[model samples]
Target: MSTVFVVGSLNIDQNIRVRSLPRAGETVRGSDATFSPGGKGGNQAVAAARAGATVKFTGAVGDDAHGRRILEVLSEASIDAGHVRVSGTAATGTAVIAVDDHGENQIIVSPGANSGITAADVDAGLAAVQAGDVLVLQLEIPTALVRQAARTAKGRGAFVILNAAPAPRQIDGLLDDVDLLVVNEQEIQVLAGLAGMPGNHRDLVQALPPALGPAIVCTAGAEGSFTVLDGSLVHVPAATVAARDTTGAGDTFVGYLAASLAGSHRDLPAAMIHATRASAIAVTRTGAMESIPWAHEIPASAPKPATPDPATPNTASPNTALSSPVVPN
Candidate 1:
């Protein structure tokens, strides 16, 4: 199995359950609050570990109690956290999350130490990257550092998966280093304005200019997800389940997907199916890292060998590609 490398943010997530999301200028009542280790990077690292992958993590946190807790969680998951940094000047990152009874959530994040990652840190974290390895990145950290890591990994023959969370306004040159682009419906909508040349979401993806590189996956919540293969759109359905809190579902899916892809036991399509099951299980639970399911909990899809996703296109343009790891593509 290939080693999976993850570089992103780490945070202490404060979760509160409410009846419904409060609109702007509104206040609502909720259930008791809970705090746990989260951050897309940490959550996905745990998810990959739970899904049977050997993982290495690179992230930043403060030299505080929350940071210690993050380390403890990583230790428990058996992830290689040697590259994790304890920032000297910043407090640990934090996220205030509100999950409605329907399982939808809104989050406000204070970058804090998550914004403390340095170029040297990224280099050290990926020092051992080798061909056939899997490199996963999220937008929680500095984009330049991520771009450097992606380019470095690509040069070393590593397969790169970029989860563009908190989706950036423009991805032009960044996509050049990534093999796969992942995004959610809302994030995809951000790019819709650029492509100004579209119909529905599917058409939007299919019509994406080749300059944006190949392989874009879009997760559309309950509606499932879709990806472009051979320039044609392929859809994958979601597993049926009653969601409790959807907090870490996307992280779970990304982690499992990266692991499955690195495992070489199946192609991206089959791995997407496997990953979807894992995320479905996560939504039925609560919290972020606490919500990710173990490998045994998900039924792995049968092997369906096929070509890898990053083979067709080359450049990444705002006028082109995307996909979030949650649903299908």
Candidate 2:
């Protein structure tokens, strides 16, 4: 199995179950308050590890009990935490989340130690990417380090997959070196200016362009995902499932998608299908890393098309080996 480098954040998630979400300035009573491992980067790292990829994680966590717990979770998943930093500057990152009976959620993040990642740390974390490897990144860290990571990882010949969660305020030239840009319905609209109207993924497919010259993936829950790659647009519909907790579903999809593409013969479309299935499984459970599906849980892929999609790899899947340039971290 190829190695996956996940350079992102690690957070202790505080989860509360509520009958209904609170409105602006309204207080609501919630039951079943719990704490668990979380953060986009941490969740994705676990997801990749479960998907059968050897994962190495790099991020900062406070020298505290929450930080230790986060590391334990990563270790339990068999991911390498050697590159993770124990920081004294700030406490471990945290997220306050409220999940309603309907499984919808409201979240507030406190970056904390996640903000301590620097360029030097990025270099140290990505040193082993010289060989064809998979580098998964997210926006939980600082943008400067994110850009540096993209450039450095690209220079080292690793394929870069960027999940632009919590869309940034400024996107100027940030995607210059990205190979694949992954975003959700609202994120795509904010980043690519392509508003994929709810329940209509066709609009995103039609409006997509290789603007930064990298493939783009926009995921819309239940409505499915749309992708533009190798001069073609492909739509992979999602499986319909009643969600119990939708938190971390996107991370599951991203982690599995990266794992399927990295060092595997699966094509982009096939990998997307695989990821979609993994995410469907995640929604049936609660928690972040805890909810991700394992490789065994993923079913065997469907037979290849008589004529494969152009985006599908002929030699190596793009995820298997990205040629320099990467999506933002």
Query: Model 2, residue 2: displacement in angstroms?
Result: 2.4
Quantify all predictions' global Cα lDDT against the true fold: 0.82, 0.79
Candidate 1 per-residue lDDT over residues 131-227, each given as its tens digit: 8888999988888988999999989988889888978877767778888777788776666665455446555555543646646677778866667
RMSD of 2: 4.9
Candidate 1, residue 185: lDDT = 80
How many residue pairs collide in each prediction? 10, 5
List where candidate 2 sits over 4 angstroms from the true fold. Answer: 194-201, 229-231, 301-329
Residue lDDT tens for model 2, 16-134: 99989999999999987899999999999999899898999989999999999999999999999998999987999999999999888999999999999887888898888864677
TM-score for candidate 1, residues paired by index = 0.89
Q: After superposition, which runs of candidate 1 have C-alpha atoms over 4 Å from their true positions?
A: 300-329
